[model samples]
Target: MKNIKIKYATTFTIVVLMFANVSAQNKSELLLQSKISGVIKKMALEEKIAMLHGNALFSSGGVKRLNIPELTSDDGPLGVREEIKRFDWNSANWTTDSATFLPNGSAIAATWNPEMANKYGVVLGQEANARKKIVMLSPAFNICRMPLCGRTYEYYSEDPFLNAQLAVQSVKGIQSQHVAACIKHFAANNQEIDRGEINALIDQRALREIYLPAFKAAVQKGSAYTIMSAYNKVNGYWCSENDFLLNQVLKKEWGFKGIVMSDWGGTHHTAEAANNGLDIEMGSSGPYDQWYFAKPLLEAVKAGKVSEKMIDDKVRRILWVMYHTSMSTGHPAGSIATEAHGKAAYDIASESIVLLKNEGNLLPLKTDKIKSIAVIGDNAIRTFASGGYGAGVKARYEVTALAGIKARFGKTADIRFAQGYKANYKASNSDEQNAGYDKPDRVLIADAVALAKTADVAILCIGSNREYESEGHDRKSLELPFGEQALVNAVTAVNTNTIIVIMAGAPYDLNEIKKSCHAIVWSWFNGSEAGNALADMLAGDINPSGRLPFTFPATLHDSPAFALNTYPGKERTTEYKEGILVGYRWYDTKKIDPLYCFGYGLSYTRFTYSGISTDRKTYKTGDKIDVMFKVKNDGKIQGKETVQLYVSKVKSSVSRPEKELKAFKKVLIAPTKTATIRISINVNDLAYFSEKQNKWIVEPGDYKILAASSSKDIRQVAEIKVMR
Candidate 1:
């Protein structure tokens, strides 16, 4: 009782101080408010339409005779999309940055690494600041509804708890640099079919329970600075103008203070969009909005249908971001061509890769034993083939796998190359592969295998193309694109010493490769310097430190969430049966074994975990526990290991994931060196949504904390009781 009183008093005092300050600043707030009011007052129909007129990435009021400041904006979670000379918004120029895609949110959640996600944030922030972008349309927090559905690449795993935790960190990272991070696809944007017009028929419980929690987590913990509304309508209402979602749920309920922007070309009706909580209508020739806001909005205020306070609220939010983004001070985002910064982009790219399989010690090939090597695959030579979507900026130079390997080996190694597969095997970019970020396929994979037969080691690059694993669509299955699966089997059949490098952007099932191949390396679209990064890692010049971002299901059938979809459901649609059991959670909860569970990855070397610690006999409200562990890289090369942590809700009233990732930390240790990792978990970390309590309530009973190198590999467990 006493503690609660103290807390309430402190909060009350703070609120009082804030209210008083606002009241005192009424004159200043009023002056700023009047600035908006004058614009509202004079907004004639034509002048209003002019206000809605947009530059490619921002907006301006063409009442230029009356001196109007242009409102500036930019591209999403990555950075600014400036229309530079030769940089046309209509035509993409390949641009590579220090930015690397952290596994989709789902895969990131599987790692359960908050600190690591925060590190990703730091890297993102540095790049966003460097690029002078005001808003990043990233840290996508949409719920994964069904499998066989495209665009899952844009979301984290299906679990809301996991998604929320990682998103908070990513958001914090971008904001740390000044620009706002957008947690997007507001309300259920589960599928991409007719995305702009699809109605997300959602029930309130589903919204509050599954789709909304991730947003709640980010808003509450990370203080996400911006939200991008989805293209779809929820419960028959457009996301941009959905009052229940934007105003009532996001603002009134969650206290979200960030700006709300429409997904590019997502806004439908201009007046309704602005009338709701939307602050900016992104990426449109929005003259309609200018007229709507100027004349209609002014009328709304005059007729008392809406308050001027709302307009001031929207514009104030925009100004707050503009002043904070501070575009003037930082160096302008330069072209990667002829620049030193481009080197850093490749460095980060190399570091982001996670090695999934190494069998029969096929990796770190002996430099001397390799008399001949065969590099075969369509993506092996195609620049920007693996890297897809968004801004596909071409480089002044590109390093192909064949070229990089040859350069690395020089006189010591004789390397032969073949087009293992055509990036577009169909000879046309019209099939499923060609339509998305598709690469040519293995119509010529046979010849590559022919070369594979005589070589001491045949490196087979078979996985996905840009069309299959990009921002516009989600992969239909966890299998490698085209007939790459068959190519892997056939190549390995002809040549036993084949090393398959899966150049993909998402987790793919490789049961055949896993069984037959000597080794497998997962390269999630390594950018401009992809070839060099792979060569360096393969040559032992750099240790492979990337970890799996998402789970590699044994088979598409093993995926619990999607299996229930019954695609083209009985009603000729789908079902989200296993609601929250997305990714490995479903497998773990139901005790199904996946081909490769979440957090599954291997290092060139090896690691062992020991010495787990948590200094507590019991946890109560406001309690925190410190956990310490040791990771020893027992291999010949010095390596970095990510210590993953997970928490489980025991005996929940509602069914729950067996374990939920709460925290994670990354530590680098020299070969034969033991590094200690200390991770802290708050009592709230073990909390669960209690149906009885109707809130996210922490149960006062027992808790188990597990420390492991990966999800399935639990190295230690400690038991603690929570007291009320």
Candidate 2:
């Protein structure tokens, strides 16, 4: 056995030296270049085809003779998914696989800080690298089209520019760690209803402006190494085999040199998929051998139906990913969930907690004044590590909100707890299951009210669970699931000094709760240190700095999709008829008042904005306009403020949004001190996608640059002229 091990190691060293010699000879080593071609030409036809499909549940095969190692693709965006067995979905049951869960996508986006996004990506990438994963299947960039979209928590925001900016930074950070960041769910995969079969019909302009910008940024700016095609169809073709989407738009136009892999069981046809830009087919219907890229592809190539060149190209891209990531980079593998990562998770959650309403200054609660406090709700004491039937990390430890609260105030104050409602973890499988899941129970409500009556102040934690907001299905409505509103009403009736903390993944109806509660905070499904972060904010240890990444519409009818009859479309086909008008664009254009505007958040301290000016009053194409603004922390507390800059065309021939976010900056200021922030906008930022011309058009006109705290609250405006 020892002699055999020595011989195998010796062989591996020789192959490694050969690859290094080829790479050194061709210093450029571009994708599909001489170094990759040399290896491909030597590969047998069967071996090349084998590299194009899953050899294991979450991995693909590699040619051992060529020294190419199997690529271990792990689910991420938050953290690495727990290890699973090679042939099945069963856990590998490894003792050291517990990872640190970072903040969810929306929660990180809420920070409105690109630097923090980069840090989040770095931690995730480091953990993935330590786990020996070459590709971290994450940084999902799907636009949040509807609040009820079950997978909204996994996405960034409705605004394309904001999403694009953050995605670029995240991709950069991940790649910096030598792990390929796979930006996923390409095209208009905005909803989860019938995800595998739904045909998304979107206009070309909307596709460019609203849905595809982030992917574009990931490719052009971030230089992402891999992309995962959405399960749904963009127009009529399945995303995995959509010729125009994958070949024309993604590959040719955007210059995406990365490999395109199908989502699990997302591929349908063999010839169409190979002919299109799909480089790999993950899993398909039935058995592993029946995958579209396996036997079918082999038969096609042998019969001259599909050329051997197509199989070679696929193998080339696969080899490219391996060469670029840790497989060839020699990043060592080990455990990496350190105390610093935990602090980073807690910091991100603290910055993401949005203070929606703080009427009469009820927040930043003084713990000394309150002798007894009631923490009533399901989420307050529950652990939120993983959810739904999708990718999730098995965290080493999770801090519940109740636990964090006790750790913070348990010594000084009497902390009381009661289960207000039972939050169901299991998602509904049928209509009967959904009905029973949503049914209300009077006993839980009575117990909560009794606890609230005795306490001086009640912190009502209420919102949807994994069942109501997760992958595999779309939510029916924005209402809180499981009779949470009834519980809130009953508790608030007993104690008027109640604070509401929404522990949901997305926005929900807050009209009734907003009226009764003294304070309201939107805390997303934060990561492993969620409770500790929430406790810090409540105890005045850290001031909240998060902003709403997407607009919270007043009602479902007010949404662009619902008003335009587009979402949850009939007959498996959904229309993005709302076009460029999504989220805040819809509300601003329709003159509708949303419950909260985009980029809206309240800090413990007050900020005063002034001295908004631009370096140039008129600018031509390619010119950069530097907008300078002064943000002063007027209140007594130290806090961070995000300065937003929006641009609007004065009078354009084509219809346009009222204003779109162009640039932003987050700055920390001392009490009574002012910070001068300078944000520059490129001339190309003024360009709008012109469908008639099939290109971006920078119309020569006067434009207004508005500096603001939120979308609606414009503080200062400067007029600028764009010359041809």
The sequence of per-residue lDDT tens digits that candidate 2 reaches over residues 1-724 is 9999999999999977867777653545643377789898898998898888888878887889878888779899769889988787788899888899888889989999988788888888888888988888889979999888878888999999999989999999888888899999887788888888899998888988889889999999999999999999988999999998899999999988779999998988999999998988887234666788988989989999889988887787777777778456456453467788898888889889999989988889898898889999988987667777657888988898899989998988899899888875476467665556665678998998999999988988888655567788877887777888889888888898899988877888888877778899888889989998888898889899999999888898999889988778889999888889999999998899998899999999999989888998899999999999889999999999988999999988888999999998889999999998899999887888988899998899999999999999999899999998
Model 2 misplacement above 4 A = 1-27, 30-32, 284-286
- What is the per-residue lDDT of model 1 for residues 470-500, given as tens digits with 9 covering 90 to 100? 5555555675665676667777888888888
Error of 1 at 440 (Å): 11
RMSD of 2: 6.5
lDDT of 2: 0.86
RMSD of each: 6.6, 6.5
CA lDDT of every candidate: 0.65, 0.86
TM-score of 2: 0.95
Query: What clash pairs does model 2 have?
Result: none
